[model samples]
Target chain A: MMNIPEDISPWLAIPVVLLLIGGSLITLIGTLGLLRLPHFYQRIHGPAISITFGAGSFLLASMLYFTVLQQRLVIHELLITAFVMLTAPVTAMLLMRTAVYRDLRNGRQSPDLKPPTPPASGHATTAGANSPGLMEETRDRNPE
Target chain B: MKLLVEIALYFSQFCIVLAMLLCMLRLLKGPTAQDRVLALDTLWICAMLFALLLGISFASLVYFEWAMLIALTGFVSSVALAKFLMRGEIIE
Candidate 1:
């Protein structure tokens, strides 16, 4: 086995240790939220914590630990960091769109889909006027 | 300091394992297909971090490569699942 360093200064070691622990704890909390939160949309918000700050802290701790130990800039970890940042939201949005589509297809009345009540002035832009199909669908559903 | 690092490593690993188990619970208990897909996405992410922590624990650069591969696989699988959900099929 390669000899692991045993003499990291407390200043450097303390923060890295703290970061790893804190990051893991946050990730645990996020996953707990995912398991406990009711409804698809509410549960959708849970993983955001792990995808952002949870992964972020661990990445930072790893980068600092490797950089200090190797005595050179070690940045390949950035690939995972960048990948997570760029793709996590895309995945979440896609899943969210899929969930919304599925709910609409089933004719489920999710409270989230309800557009705000427009004023009597009659100048409210239909919530999603850009999508005429969905707009018409919702209007038909709530013919008030 | 070495002992401290060791403790942190073990603690992080424990937390990640717990998270992974929770994700599995969601995956199995999901009332909808989308929920299962989301759980899978989160599970792979936890696995990736688990590999990374292993890299640190072993003091090997190899596990870093493993971490990268896991990340790539997680993103691809999640994207594919989401696309499948968007369309009725994956390949068209």
Candidate 2:
């Protein structure tokens, strides 16, 4: 395998390495959060953090590294950056909608239905709301 | 220096591998189908980044193309999975 030239300036290398490390760390933390978050709604936010900023830093570092190595502007990495920016949110929103659809179909009280109620009681009430009055009360509090 | 670059690359690779493993754990343990699908999407994104990091470390352009392909395929699969979840079937 060809090695990165030893003669490249530290100024460039340092920033590139920092970016790469920072981005990878962000991705690691985000994925860890994804695994640990209790509810799907909360968990949905975890990947978004990585997808937006984590991938961005990595792409920027790749662009700079290749540009320095090739001694020219390396624009191809831009394609991945732009494509990811466009697609990640779309995928996230679609998944969120799907989750909400599933919850509603099962008559479960989804997060979007309420602002920030305690999850335990919300779940309990929604689980056994044989009376429409309680459902109405939930809707009244949420208003959406 | 080459040492610094090497260190950064190795560290990034290690982090990404851990990230992918966490994503897999979520995928396998997710309570609902949508949760699994979301985990799969995140997993693919992590894989794409991993490929790019490898490309950077090896100074090989081939890995960039691999990364791009992974992104394309990952997006398509995720969209299809989401559609299936939304409609109960992928095709009408």
- List pairs with backbone clashes in candidate 2: none
Error of 2 at A11 (Å): 1.7
Candidate No. with top DockQ: 2
Please give the fraction of native interface contacts (Cα pairs under 8 Å between A and B) kept by each candidate.
0.68, 0.78
lDDT tens string, model 2, B1-92?
77898889899999999999999999888878888999999999999999999899888889999999999999999999999988979879
The DockQ-based CAPRI class assigned to model 1 is medium
Models, CA RMSD each? 6.4, 5.8
Top-TM-score structure, candidate number: 2
Lowest summed lDDT over 10 consecutive residues: which window, candidate 2 chain A? A135-144
Give the per-residue lDDT of model 2 (tens digit) for A66-122: 898888998798999889999988998889888877766656566444543554555
Count of clashing residue pairs in every prediction: 0, 0
